[model samples]
Target: MRAVGIAVFLGLLAGAWSQVASPVLRPDCDALEVEEAALVAQDYMNSQLTHGYKYALNQIDEVKTIPRPDGGENYVVEMDLLETKCHVLDPTPVANCTVRPRQETKVEADCDVVLSKVGGVLSVVAYKCKSEPESAEDVCLGCPQLVPLNDTSALQLVDASLGRFNRVLDNDTARFALLEVDRLATKPLAGTPQYLAEYAIIETNCTNDDDDNCVPLASPVARKGFCVAAGTPAFTAAVDCALFTNEVAPVDPTLNGTGPVAPPVVPKLQTTHGLKHHHRLSSVNVPAATGLLSESEESQEVVPVVKRQAPMDTLLELPVVPAVPLPPAAAPVLQLCPGRKRHF
Candidate 1:
């Protein structure tokens, strides 16, 4: 009976393991679909290089699909291409140097074309591309293939790497402006996954003019050992100097320096009343009567007060002459005169 119980326990363990170890299905896209996606990527590449430079298709290296949680696929297409740019010298009447000189550069580009099924048809949803520098160090290059896992985790790793790269170089304005992802790779490590990335830092605005141009500087840097699906995503990564240590060579002091390595200064609006001043006023003990008074109250209190007085009379001596003007009263005699009879 003990042996039978042991066998049953082993069988149960196997069943649980099988459930946890189920294989993920590969993406539903086929070879024809991959070729179509590559064409789309090629068109995208051409559109980006439309500005004076030209690009020629070299070859489509590989096409692979990464499964999405929402039943979609991300077709990662890798390709190599050559770019040509012309540096035309100004024509002069004396030298007649009108002949334009052209330069060619070779680069590898990886395009991620995302597709999703809609109304029973697979349609393109989103796409992005990263161009590889020609002379970047090999240590900065990511693995050629990505691990067969969820693309969400891989993308999260890429995002974390990008955030760190931006934060680290943000101080140096010239270095920050030109930093871009050159390559990205992923591989399975133990039970988890790791990502490797390369970044190209080029001083694109460099020119001979010291007043307006930045000093020319360029380098390739590598950031590796980014573990995805880790407990702490942001802190679990490392960056190394693939081309230069700590930082690139400092710009020439005589050249138009980028001032200082600091974060962009946002002009703060000046305010008459600031929070510190408000707090300071609140902390002081002000008399209740003086609360409404302003700073000019002291000057108003120093003015002299005017005294009011009664008016003086100028006609005081004229009243004594009125008493003598009333003379003594005289007696009058009454005469008895006869009146004539009235005629009828």
Candidate 2:
């Protein structure tokens, strides 16, 4: 009877030990480690974008953990984000930047990030994001705030801003031309309706005065930028721009001497993770240097010229560093780790 009792006790102890040692497949989202992994994933995802406003965490839709055989864990975080006023190259920290006002068109992104942890260290494995722009109907209680892309008055404002930008630079080497109209909105300020615009520009083959017909230069080198402009149709209040160039030139399709040359469609701006894009243009002389734009007298902000060292694909594989804590108020998403740090 004593030997039988000992065997039963030993079996119970082994079962308890196995329960404690087994990996957790569905850890609580509020767990400190899970929160840390989400923060790290957000930081890495934002670092991949070289242009546009930084995305602030709006909500954590879901968080899950998968246990690996090697004692490592994979964290999958799904989050919603809203655009902030902070530019990617701006020196100002994202925590200090304010979310874009409701009067403007709302641009939001949904991101799915996967991170792996081993030996108490975290690394981003993969991430993808989808961005959308919504009209600001709630601002005026069902009144549309988003201006039509083909609005004549809005187009005039954008053109005026571009003309002013060219005149300000007065660069004899290269002239910038409008590439696409990203957004246009109308909002009341000081009891007056004002126009706001977000657009893109490229160094073109034509001179600054040749605005009637202009196309991007077909050289190995190219300069592209995103700009924000605001003001009345008669005058532009402000124009802030950030320019970038690709480190490696895209392949020229005409060199093959096979297929007919195809017309260029406005390439979708890869503000976040996306497939590589190629642009084709007629051959033209590209300036050795893309002259910088001076500080906008009206905006009081200096234009930034950033160069992308590698293609979009290479940026995804970049090594992520320790994250900087974002302000709790900015990202009211997960209340995970109350007294601990959070980032977006």
Candidate 3:
């Protein structure tokens, strides 16, 4: 019996050794994609923002990017609109966001960081965003006191820039920027007229060369943008050109349920063919030394101006862009321990 007992113990020890407890090792392929997607998402958002801000604000700077939960980060695109907070994350002490269908997807992101107006005054980045799972067309998301985008005050900047002629709104330079917003996101006008003005500005400003800065209104490459903006059949000719590129088919307007169209109350400036647009004559001698952009050149290249007889469209035309960038040298990063910091 003693020998048998010793043999049983040995067998138990052998079985335990054969199935020894071990740390589970994950395969690279099997690792969850959340982190990777989050990284991509962070980068994607930043790229779009850099593209948006450089054009919208003439420059992009003072970025305070912070990490998100899923290995991503959020940035401070426009930090100035503290009164109404109609902008991106800034002034607010905390920032938050949620992935749709939160239960189905464990992914989420949020960040907290300080914002400052070091360079040019931080303008608000008009967002085509939904504040919560359920929001009405007339109301701003999250903040009740906040006015809807359709409000005159919400778009006061554009109106101020476009409405007055003798006193050109210095900020009217944003006109050329609007169309690129639509091109980048492909979302039609939200409930705001500011977006509409922005669209008009983009279409008017786009040239083959400056699609990076302004939107090409009648480009041969993308008919969808022209289709939305064009009432005349010039769009068809543009579509015929092989240059038009819409990687995906036309989106279904009716796919979603009944929603708010652009609020008529949203202001409308004088547009050719009743479409919110800028029009210029075919023949005009524009100078190239002062960054003065003719309608054609504005869309095609960044050049100087000779300022001829002011056409109707020149009312809100962009002034000569600074031939140079602002704050020539980079600003010092806000360091926690200046000169005393150590890096690992």
Highest lDDT scorer: 2
The residue ranges of model 2 lying beyond 4 angstroms of the native Cα positions read 1-32, 47-53, 86-98, 103-105, 119-137, 140-144, 169-173, 188-193, 205-221, 242-344
Residue 155 shift from truth in candidate 1, angstroms: 42
Pick by lDDT: 1 or 3, better one? 1
lDDT of 2 by residue, 1-344 (tens): 44444444445445444434442244455576766776675555555555566666666655656565688876766656677766554445566768765545557666656566788778766555667665444455533376667777878999999888877854465678886675677777777778888777778887765665767875446677778899989989998776765434323354775544432222222452221211111111112211111111121111122222444454445445355433333322344422221233
> What TM-score fits each model?
0.23, 0.53, 0.20
| Model 2 C-alpha RMSD to native | 19.5
Candidate-wise lDDT, in order: 0.34, 0.58, 0.24
User: Candidate 1: misplaced stretches above 4 Å?
Assistant: 1-30, 48-57, 66-73, 84-103, 117-124, 136-344
Number of clashes in model 2?
0
Task: State the lDDT at 222 in candidate 2.
Answer: 61
Choose the strongest candidate by TM-score: 2
lDDT of 3 by residue, 1-344 (tens): 44544444445444444323221111222122222322222322322221111111111111323233444333322111101111111112212322222221111112111211223222111121111112235333332222233434324433333223112322333222332211110112343222222222222444333334544445433332211121111111111101123223223244563443331121111112212211200121213211212132112222222223333344334333334322333344442211110110
- Global CA lDDT of candidate 3, please? 0.24
Q: Return the TM-score for candidate 2, rounded to 2 decimals.
A: 0.53
Ranked by lDDT, the better of candidates 1 and 2 is: 2
Cα displacement (angstroms), candidate 1, residue 97, comes to 28
